[model samples]
Every structure is written in C-alpha cells, then in structure tokens.
Target: MIIVIDGLNRHRFGAVLDEMYRLRARVFGDRLGWDVDIRDGKEIDQFDHLDPAYVVGLDDEGHVVAAVRALQTTGPHMLADVFNAILDGEPPIRSATMWESTRFCVDTKRLGRGRDRHSVSYATCELMIGSLEFARRSGIRDIVTVIDPVMDRVLKRSDNAPYGYVGKTAPMGKVPALAALLDCTQERIGRVRDFAGIAHDVFLTEDAALDLFARGHTSVEIETAAHAASANNDTRPLSALERYFVEQMSAARTSDEVQAVIDLIDALPGTLTPEQKFALKQAPAALAREA
Candidate 1:
C-alpha cells in the first residue's frame, strides 16, 4: 500500500534510511556519477538535518520501492542556498511560496511490475498535493522546484501551464533543467489537466515529446477551461470535508470572503491518508456546485 506519513519519528525514518541511501547510490552515485560517498549504503547531507522535510512512499514487506523528499524555503536550506551563484540573482524564491523537491528515486527492479509503478506514481502525487496544502496554510501561494527535464514535462501535463517565470538556460550536464513554478490556488488547481493542449509551446519540441512519454505523463485531451467548467457544473456527489469547504465557498460573497474560505481549506490537516487527501484536494471545487 502507498502511505504518506508526516512527523515521522526518527526511529521510523531510520528504518527506511538504508533503502533511501541505496536508492541514492544507485541513481545518483553510480548512474549519474555524482560525488556522493556511499558509506554503509546511507546518503546523509547537512540539508537533510536542518530542514523540516517529509518522506512519502511505500514499505513493501521490507523494501522501499519509491521515495521523494520535500523542504520548505524558510532558512538556509532552500535550493537557492546551494545553487545561488548559478541562478540569476538568486531568483527571488524567498518571497514565493515554494517547496524544493529533491532526491526523487524509484527502484529499477520494480519498473515492469504493475502495482509497484502505480504505488510510486500515487505516492508522488500525494506528496505534491501535501506540499501544496502545507504551503497554503503558511501563506505561500507559489510552488517552485528544480526537476529533471523529463519530470518537468510530467508535471506540466499533470497540471495546466505553470504560473511563474522560467529562468534562462541552466546546465543539467548536457541536457538543461528547467525551473518551473505553479500557483497552488483553488482556481489554479481546477485548471489542472492531464495534458497540455497542442497549441501550447510544450508540444513544439521533439525532445519534449519524447520526455513526456518516457516519464509516463498520462494524456487527457480536455482543455483547461473545459475541465474547469465541467468541475464547476458537476453536482453529482461529495465527501463531508468537501461539503464543508464547498458550502464555505458558496457563502463567500466577496473576494476577501473567497480568500477566507481558501485559508480555511489550506489550514486543514495535511497528514491525511493518500486517498482521503486527494479527495480533499479535489473536493472543494467539485462540491461547491452542490452548495
């Protein structure tokens, strides 16, 4: 089962530390040839100790098949902290609501298996949603992350166009890594589609097209405006938390009132089970119509 645990006590974290280390060693140490010392199969770094980070993935019997780590941009731990000189004037990431996602890894042995891949994908989406929820509560409206070029295309297809600026070309060895940003708002959430329209610049490059498929970017042809309309018009059903948020949004008569509703939703619990959390993240707009 794919589970997302927050406030992970050090013991539970220690249980999976080896799996994380081996994963990093396999992907970064050996595959990418990063200068990481794989001591006793554990990857440790200063940022891992300083940041209030969370780990999301599965513990199948005894092996960890997938994992991703997230960190807030509050102190010396921001991505800009390490890459400041490389970025153009620090990129203003401190002023934005952002989460730096790093060390994403999946077990290569689990690739051909059906359930394992699904679990990994689901856990990843839940982590992203949880990060957005955390940002909302903290008064951060934007999310920024440096992803592998392939992963960046996956995110673009999973949502509508990203909301912020893309920086000038930066090196990712031979291929370039893009700095993509998203607005984690209810309206923007509603705008998310499984595929970007062909008219968008994303579909113009052969490399981009290949990367999209390689990363398993699920394709849904629905346009963003049409998806939002469908979500707004559908009044079929909703969960209790969904009903509560929907009614609050319906009662909102002004911009401030709408924002208040958003704030309330953002401040709600961030540690929900993956399934319940996805429902919570998607429910407000779907249920608001019924109210």
Candidate 2:
C-alpha cells in the first residue's frame, strides 16, 4: 500500500520516512553511483527539510520500498536549484499550479527484476498513480519531474510516459537526466492503474500502517520500556494515548524523529515538556491533525 507523508503529519510516519531515505541511498549511491551526499546510510539534502510531500510505497511488511518527493515549483526545487544546468538556457519552469517530483526510485534488491505485482513494475506504477491522484486532489494542475534516463525508459515501458517535457537532456551527476511533465488528471491515473492491474485502494491509514510494522511491542514501546524501567520509581506510567504516541516513534533514529513525535504530541492536550517527551519518546499529544 501507499502512504502519503507531508510536513504536517510526518511525525506519525517517521520509520517509513527513514526507510525511504535509506532506500534512496541504496539505489542512487550504492547501486547507481549517483553523486549525492550519503551520511549515516541516508541520502537526505536541503530539499527534504523544505516540507515537500512524499508519496511512499510500502510492502506487506510495512517497510518503505518506493518513494517520490513532491515540491511546489513556485519555490526551491531540484531543477530550479541543483540541476539548473539541465535547463540548457531555457527559463526554469515555475508556477503555483505545478509541482516538482524528484528522487523517484524503488527497492530493486527486495523486489528483484520480475514483472509481476511484487516487482518494480507494479511499485513504479503505484508511485505514479499515487502522485497523480494526490496532485489532482490537491488542486495541482501539472507535475514536473527530474529523472534519470533509466527511469524515463521504465515509464515508457509501463505505458505511462510523460505527457510532455522541458529542456534537453543533460549530464546530471553520473547519469543523463531531464525534466518531464505529467498532467494531474484521472486519465493519467487510470492509465497507470490499468497497466499495473491494481483495482484496490493503495493507501493505508496511519494506525493500520503502525500495526503492520509489527504485531505487538513496537520499537518505540520497547525503547521506552528499557529506559523507563531503569528510571527512578517515582515516574508514573504513561496514559493510553501517551503510549500510542511513543509507539509511533519506534522507527525514529535521530533528533528529527524525536521532534516529529513531539509535533504530534503538541496537538494533544498535555503538560509534557520537550525534554520530558524526548527522554521517553512520549509524544508531547495525540494524533488529530491531518498530514
């Protein structure tokens, strides 16, 4: 299934986001030898902090297997900033109704080279469908993507080629890349759906996603328990809502992860300080806002 992670609700899907970053590292850095910064096994950059929406594909195990980042063209984006050379002297495309999709990749190591539903074909189409569907719903009229030649061919083979393109192909990092434009419409979504033979909804609710990560004792719970048990006896047990908040942070591996959980906690009525919440993985509240 697919999970949409945005700036507002990223905290709820911290682990899945981490998995997406790691997958990008594996695909672009380890396998494709792309020139990207890989620190601590994650290929993250300034754009990631720009509050772009992420369309992530998760396998049956709730691990991130595919993902694409979406950023509004009116502001800083990969092509406008990093790959401005690819424009070949043409003005960078910038508009409010147009969004930019980048960092498109799938987990080839786990899915292999097969063409079946479990393979890259299905996941790639699903990411396309998710992006189109999401953009259409968000009042976005078009999508501009910066992708390598390999991905361009994959799109054509899947019968979901870009509706149009911009500029000429240029050497981007280790691969030749270019800008392609896709319309955000039902027609595009239907084409990808038919090609992938996917008739079911591809999105999963947050709770369902968390449950699928593990049957019980989520990593957050495990971590919190380990620390709480060693704390002074005066500490009180967490409320039911508080426990749920912490459980969602099990996949977090950094201060950002901890802060994401803190953002959600801020929505819930609580007296928890940032320090207290970080120490115990206690969400500084409950899940109530939209992501």
Encode model 1's per-residue lDDT on 1-291: one tens digit a residue.
Answer: 223333544333443455566777776677655545677767666667764454434433335555566666666543576545336665546653566656766665554433222454443444455455445655767766665566666566556356654455465543455566777775554443222111111111322322232222111111222233343445434456655654554443345665566666566676333443343334233212111
Range of the 10 consecutive residues with the lowest summed lDDT in candidate 2: 282-291
How many residue pairs clash in all the candidates, one count each? 0, 3
Instruction: Name the candidate that leads on lDDT.
Output: 2
Candidate 1: worst 10 consecutive residues by lDDT?
195-204
Q: Which stretches of candidate 2 lie above 4 Å from their native place?
A: 215-291
Which clashing pairs does model 2 show?
Answer: 220-250, 265-284, 265-285
> Model 2, range 81-119, lDDT digits (tens) per residue?
888888888888889999999999998878856667688
Evaluate model 2: give its lDDT.
0.77
Runs in model 1 deviating more than 4 A are 1-8, 35-37, 59-62, 113-123, 133-140, 173-175, 186-291
